[model samples]
Target chain A: MKLTIPGEELMGHGNLSCQGCGGSLAMRYALKALGRDTIAVIPACCWSIIDGPFPYSCLKIPVFHTAFETAASAASGVSAAMKIKGKKTTVLAWAGDGGTFDIGIQALSGAAERGDNIIYICYDNEAYMNTGIQRSSATPYGAWTTTTPAKKFKSAPKKNMVEIMVAHKIPYTATACIAYPEDFIKKIKKAKGFQGTKYIQVLAPCPTGWRYDPAKTIELSKMAVESGIYPLYEVENGIYKISRKAKNKTVKEYIKMQGRFSHLTGEVIDEMQKNVDKEWELLIRKEEFYGHTKE
Target chain B: MKKVVTGNYAASYGAKVSRAEVVAAYPITPQTQIVEKIASFVANNEMDAEYIKVESEHSAMAACVGASAAGCRAYTATSAQGLALMHEMLHWAANARLPVVMANVNRAMGPPWTVWTDQNDSLSQRDTGWLQFYCENSQEVFDTTIQAYKICEKIGLPGMLVLDAFILSHTSEPVEIYDQDRIDKFLPKYNPRYKLEPSETHAFGGLTTPEWYYELRYKIQSAMDEGLKEIESVGKDFGKMFGRKYGLIEKYRCDDIDTLLVMSGSTASTGKEVIDRLRDNGERIGLARMRVFRPFPKQEMRKLAEDVNKIIVIDRNISFGNEGIFFSELKSALYNENTDIPVYGFIAGLGGRDITMKDIEGMIKKADGKPKDIIWWGLK
Candidate 1:
């Protein structure tokens, strides 16, 4: 099959997204790779507002702005319908951390378990930006949102959604970041080739929610990967392959860039760093275990 | 082919003959056998459809929504918890106006988690805008499943074919499985007038501003209202071809009866038997079975309630704090009428308990002795 990366900007420029919003860029690049044969299912989040109002759509493809918890199931339906009509199109469910990890977990789990032929991408911005920056299950420890102020920061670690996806024994699962555009696009394109359920969790930095300089969006994403906070890896048929191995930058480099973690003291930063290191080590062991099993 | 078959198999056979292109399913008791049969049909190449084994009922409905939006006829089946899980997507399927057909094996919602027959599961979603049809027997289950697709596509609204859990879902009855050729002649390929195609760019699930939101809702309401007539016509056409006619409401021995027993789903069969037995013994008792519940069948219900001095509604589902869900709708439907009939609501067979002819006789006896406001029958 001839591969044609879309050159047309289906997601038009001059939208209302914040400067260098990683979520906005994720949609832009995803559309480029998937082409016009795509329907984006967006839930209640920044993208829902970013997609522009009715009669003036920002993207060229049809977008189904669904309820906060329905993106996964809605996308699953669209994908099944497409297969029935003999239309080879990708149904992409684009949701935020709050939508994916909290409200929409049941629907997401259902779609994954059924192996519905759909690509569900969660743009993890750490917190709910659309609903006034509330803490979500995906919010990392020590992060500050409207719900978790400096007086009471988030105590729990971010929910390991990748592990949950792995439990479903889906055909494809991967972690990517908007900072690595090539890797993110590659994972999405690779997911399209597989026939069953595929999932990708992309670390999208929110300048508004994270309280960061708008220009540091890409930089923060890169720091997240370098610090091993977000590893780029793919799980193909239960075989884990770490696509991008970090050079191991200090976690401080990633935390200092975001205001959500600005209130953390030296001890809290170190604790978060230790947690990140432990998680990264476990991910490495997983890659080794799954890789050896595949061989 | 005429054969003794479970209600689940009859519904599965109906979907197969209808040539449903997609079936997204999650297993819930009573409804599980229906999907299992459909899966076997797909596996055996008896049907050309994508069998999506979803993890939850919510996704099952979601997958159906996607398939329907892509311009393909989609099918799914669930009961109780599964139906509750798909509650959110049920509204979306209707609001999106996708002609997705689902079979809800009606089961009681639980604090007890019992897997038994009840109308609460489907009736709870009464306001979701999808058309609801209750089946009385295996034959109605088969015919209604086929007729649902036609009615749904005609009105561009999703339709649910509901049967009493355990009673119809597990019980075996004689059903004539219509041939594929006959089904093809009756239900042509489903061609959706509005679909999510890239060639024709249109907004779906877009932000409906104040200017058109109410109008869009009113249109859906009007579509549902129009569906009432469409369901009756389709039922007439189906009966003419298959030699079995079904109206929005099925009336029996109500011509001169002073008291009418109103019910829906499989228990209605038992009610009919009870009514026949009573009629033979010089009792002026009749039965009214509601086939269509969404458009409410207000006209037919009024006509049936007109001559009756007392109306007894047997509901298998409850609305918790309120009376029987169907009974509330019935009372509201007849509130303004000048009829002097005292309508009584009876909640029975909840949590899948068997509603035998004895239970019907007991309820009819109670209604005969000064009809109460709401009676909880068959309770321990």
Candidate 2:
């Protein structure tokens, strides 16, 4: 069965996000998948500014702009309150990487553990783009972010947030990308079909933060997946299925498009490449193991 | 029906009668009974509400903020550290203009942790844009808590119904209970003008640019001003229905008095005794009880101290560098009123230290007919 993306537009044009902002497009696609019968709980992030100021919201759906680190708990509350009203409102916890992987993890974990009937989507642009591109836990190893200057670049690997969510034993968890809108929208629609906690971490690129050209946002997202830097996959009830397989592009091809990684030496690049290959193999073994068991 | 219940139980009953749709709370001493009673109410199916037994005080308030924003009558209760821990969400609930009513069983802040009653816990949260009401008794606790829903819902601002820790929270008193059906007529179901509904999509608590941020906060302040104006009138209607009044300030025999001694919470009843005894002894003294702490109750403070020669405030909370918090607040309220009454700030209770009628009398005696600094009353 072919899943068609909804033609309905919940996000309006001329919003505040920087040009070619992948996080902005992720929201547009997310709203399309969920449609208008939704309430969005947004924490402080790039999307906070992207959703225009008060009295001039860009989203057509009702939005609840929350504190810096309360998207999940707020969505949990919104959904709980809606249940009492007997309204079928899809509450969306839309946040950025900083709000998700760092400050918001506590609230997110609490909500997930409780198995709240809400969908929490973190449109990760890697660094803290809203606060001037500081290095976040989601920032890749050897990448140059504002806080992690070229001297002592981000040496930590990108946090495996999908594994974290899967460990919560949630009903659904997935990784999506802007380059794969159909797959992204399909996974979101699938999440909506589930009753308990659903988390989708989308790899959205920031043109300004990632030091890439405005036109290369989709290209970067595509390369990130093709290089196994960010593979698209879904984990449902302990079963894993690779949504998009890597095309075997080197990490060099992926990093060449962005200036954030331009400062890396050949030795450092090899170290990063080794880590990525190891990560990809681990991911494949899990998919093979879980996928085999399911079959 | 009437029942002998603790003030905490009274708060739990109040939420039930209000038909609160969502309640999220964590347990702390004194305040534990309030949440436990609420949990039992939900467990027994006495209340048709979502009782989210959250992991912590922070999540408890966060859940309530979500519930309230989603257009439900939300309620919670806490004391001291729990209240302090819930501080961030408290600001969010108020700023979002979600009418989330909370009952804070006032307790002393910790160092050498104690569960005794004091005002510092709530007083420290003065500027969170939440309306505050201190109950003088368990009966008032029940009535005022219900009134708090009406108060917050009317103005679209959050409010707290405060009662003393063990003195009221743990101690039982006879409280008149009104059935849900009867209470429903007085306080109808919350009809939100705007909510988290796709039926009428709108952005709430959005990121306002500085160009518009000031006005949005100004609107909150304007709502506060409107709340102050509407409180007494709402109390009148509540009294007409329930035979109990919830005013900004509960004054006891303050008319035509020379020396006015002011206090809040359960201490009002004890202070009133001291006032009566002093009056019988031919001393012109009266007790002024602070009911609503936020919105400042400036008009009432000015009126209470209008004819008095001296005003002595016995605060259970301190402001660190400044005088007693209530003393500072009341003093500021009378600053522009042009009243030359020598207002004295007396720090009487801190860290669960017992405050009694004799201690209040000592505060009155220590007032040296001068606008002096805060005197640490009863300090050895």
Off by over 4 Å in 2: A1-3, A292-295
Error of 1 at B201 (Å): 3.5
How would you encode candidate 1's per-residue C-alpha lDDT over A1-295 as one tens digit per residue? 6544456787886566877788899888888778887888887889877887666678888887777787888788788778767889788899998999999998898788777788999999889887788999999989999999998999998999989998999999999998887788888999999988888999998899999899888888888988888888999999988988864788898888888888999998888888889988999999998888878
lDDT of 2 by residue, B268-307 (tens): 8989999989999989888889988888888888877778
Q: What is the TM-score of chain B in candidate 2?
A: 0.98
Q: Name the weakest run of 10 consecutive residues (lDDT summed) in model 1 chain B.
A: B199-208
Clashing pairs in 2: none
DockQ winner? 2
Alpha carbon deviation, residue A291, candidate 1 (Å): 6.7
CAPRI grade of model 2? medium
